[model samples]
Target: MFTGLSAFPLTPMNEQGVNEHEFIRLVECLAEAEVDSIGVLGSTGNYAYLSSEERARVAKLSVENAGNVPVVVGIGALRTRDVLANAENAQQAGAGGVLLAPVSYQKLTDDEVFSLYETVCRSLSVPLCVYDNPGTTHFHFSDELHGRIAQLPQVASIKIPPVQNDLAAAKARVAGLRALLPSDVTIGISGDPAAATGLLAGCDAWYSVIGGLYPEIALALTRAAQAGDTEQAIARSAALEPLWALYQEYGGSLRVAATIAELTGNVSQPCLPQPLRTLQGEARKRVEAVIDMLSLS
Candidate 1:
């Protein structure tokens, strides 16, 4: 079900819980833009920062606001039982599917990863997308482990964030994974800036951040790449390079905060969990410059 640009909408928060009103406005914008899918509670959604109850509420809210678009809720938690709980709630909230990642404080092994996914999958009737974001999870999956997870029942897709952004290198990686994965299983690219490269190389979707704020730009870029319009695709994605550089320089959390702030102003200012600061100094200035030039006017 994941295809084109899947907008990873941010869960903008202040001291008082989720700021539901602001969150609603953001989802409404995405619905109006007609993004391919709305992925709430992803790392971009700050799933780790909210409680299971809070996440369930966000899932239900997204579905209500999403209109014709599919809503995939992230169900990554530190414990297996917690993941199961999150999945149960998401299914109950009428979510189209669930995105899962091995969010761990302690390092996890292949067997452990398989069992966690297996447990969560067994409890739900909805499709599951394996979120392979090593930067957040700290659990890298070998090709062998990735293949094993793809075999699980109800598993429909794998979202891969490439270690390197080089087009040829990214293509080789997608080819290797495509060979091991079942023919029906979709390969999604979350390595944003490399997304054009990945889509050009045959990935089925782009799990995106900018799409959350600028879906029109995102879809145009996706269409270009999908139609083999190499120059258009590269140029469109290249226009996003400054923001991508900031995502690399700071992190997704910081840069995403900056992007949303530009989109919706101070209400969208980030309130990450302890030890993580919002964008400041030159980082914030760089985000403003990129947003000024590239954000929808």
Candidate 2:
């Protein structure tokens, strides 16, 4: 479940809450495309905004519609108690795995972060992926800390942030982490822009945002890298540079991804949660232009 393309689809929403039909369609789309896994309620899925009931329902819907594709549900929360509840909900919904980020209001120490994983791991019936998304969680994991948490039971994979653009440097960074982790624990790469680099550098998986929207293209790139076709993988990633630039310009992938979903009619006009608006005016136009130019459906 940790290996290959694990697409993180957005949890399309409406005034009535989660757009169940659209969410199911998105899951089925990924399943039809044969992605290695479907990650519902990730950052891209707006997991932070959804209530516990909504999250559990989303997990159930995703698992129900994902066909044979394994589903990994995000179980992040501010308090450990809430995190455990979320984890329980995911497990009850039949999630193949759970992704946990060290979400916090105040800064968390390494010990606190480690304890969080230890506490959660004890309760998780399914395997857990350590989500090292410092961008959102604000708690960065050192190699030492990652080693410590990875030693715990039920920890199957560690989703590291983007590595350096330089392939050699990326390889060294991945190798360093691999040496610390147990042989059974896989290393999955997030940060879409650096996916090719990370995969070509010997990472085991791509926890992708773009993959959720365009699974065929993303899967091609992932397969190329995993097959050791370095030139093809790099070229494929370069082709998506425009989209990656949009991610940088738009501040993050959430707005851009929501824009794509809307543009493609996969979701309603206002799919994001309140206070988090989709791309508008010229920004939306730019995204539309790129989508058309790139022939992205």
Residue-level lDDT tens digits of model 1 in 1-297: 687878887787755688788778878888999888899999877899898889999999999999998999999999998898999899999999999999999999889999998888789898999999888898888888889988988898999985355677777888999899888889998867777888888889988876776778889998898898978998987887876777777766445554545444735555555455566777666667767776545
Each model's lDDT? 0.82, 0.95
Q: Find the candidate with the highest TM-score and give its number.
A: 2
Q: Using alpha carbons, what is the TM-score of model 1?
A: 0.94
Error of 1 at 184 (Å): 1.3
Candidate 2, residue 18: lDDT: 93
Relative to the unseen true structure, what is the C-alpha lDDT of residue 259 in candidate 1, on a scale of 0 to 100?
Answer: 54
Q: Give candidate 1's whole-model lDDT.
A: 0.82
Q: Estimate, for each residue in 1-297, the C-alpha lDDT of model 2 and write its tens digit.
A: 999999999999976799898889989999999999999899999999989999989999999999999999999999999999999999999999999999999999999999999999999889999999989988889999999999999999999999999999999999999999999999999999999999999999999999999999999999999999999999999999999999999888999999999998999979999989999999999999999989997
> Where does candidate 2 stray beyond 4 Å?
none
